[model samples]
Target: MSFYSGIDLHSNNHVVVVIDEEDNKVVDKRIDNNLHTTLEVLAP
Candidate 1:
């Protein structure tokens, strides 16, 4: 299986989406607007 990721960054927050090889969304989240926090939110 393969996976992909997408992130939408704004001034206040971030929207993250993860999809699989079949193009099905696996994870979706709204997270804090910082590098550490964003990484934490997206970490496996």
Candidate 2:
């Protein structure tokens, strides 16, 4: 299956979302601006 992701970035936090090819949500949450945290949430 294929997946897609998007992020709304701000100064201190970000909202990240991941969806499948079928438009089903895989991950949808807000995370800290830290790269590690963002990557962790984006991980498959």
Candidate 3:
């Protein structure tokens, strides 16, 4: 399986989108604007 990730950075927060090769979204949501939290959320 393959995955594609996109990050929409805004002034207040960030939107994350994780998709597959067929453009099927695996995960989509918004998170707090912070480096540590972002990494933690993305960590596997």
Candidate 4:
């Protein structure tokens, strides 16, 4: 199965959405704009 990720970027934070092959949402997160924070939000 494959996964897809979409990010809604903002000046101070981001909204991240991850979906599975069937288009079911797996993760929905809002995190700071920092690189480390963004990576942590997307990490498995």
Q: Which candidate model has the greater lDDT, 2 or 4?
A: 4
lDDT of 1 by residue, 1-44 (tens): 98899998888998999999999988898887888987886678
- Which stretches of candidate 2 lie above 4 Å from their native place? none
Q: Record all residue pairs in model 4 with backbone atoms less than 3 Å apart, i.e. clashing.
A: none
Top candidate on TM-score is 2
The Cα local distance difference test for each model comes to: 0.87, 0.88, 0.87, 0.90
TM-scores for every predicted model: 0.77, 0.88, 0.77, 0.86
Question: Regarding TM-score, does 1 or 2 come out ahead?
Answer: 2
Task: Report the backbone clash tally of model 1.
Answer: 0
The deviation in Å at residue 23 for candidate 3 is 1.3
Q: What is the per-residue lDDT of model 4 for residues 1-44, given as tens digits with 9 covering 90 to 100?
A: 89999999998898999999999999999888888887887788
- In candidate 3, where is summed lDDT lowest over 10 consecutive residues? 35-44
| Candidates ranked, most accurate by lDDT first | 4, 2, 1, 3
| Best candidate (score: lDDT) | 4
Candidate 3 local distance difference test against the native: 0.87
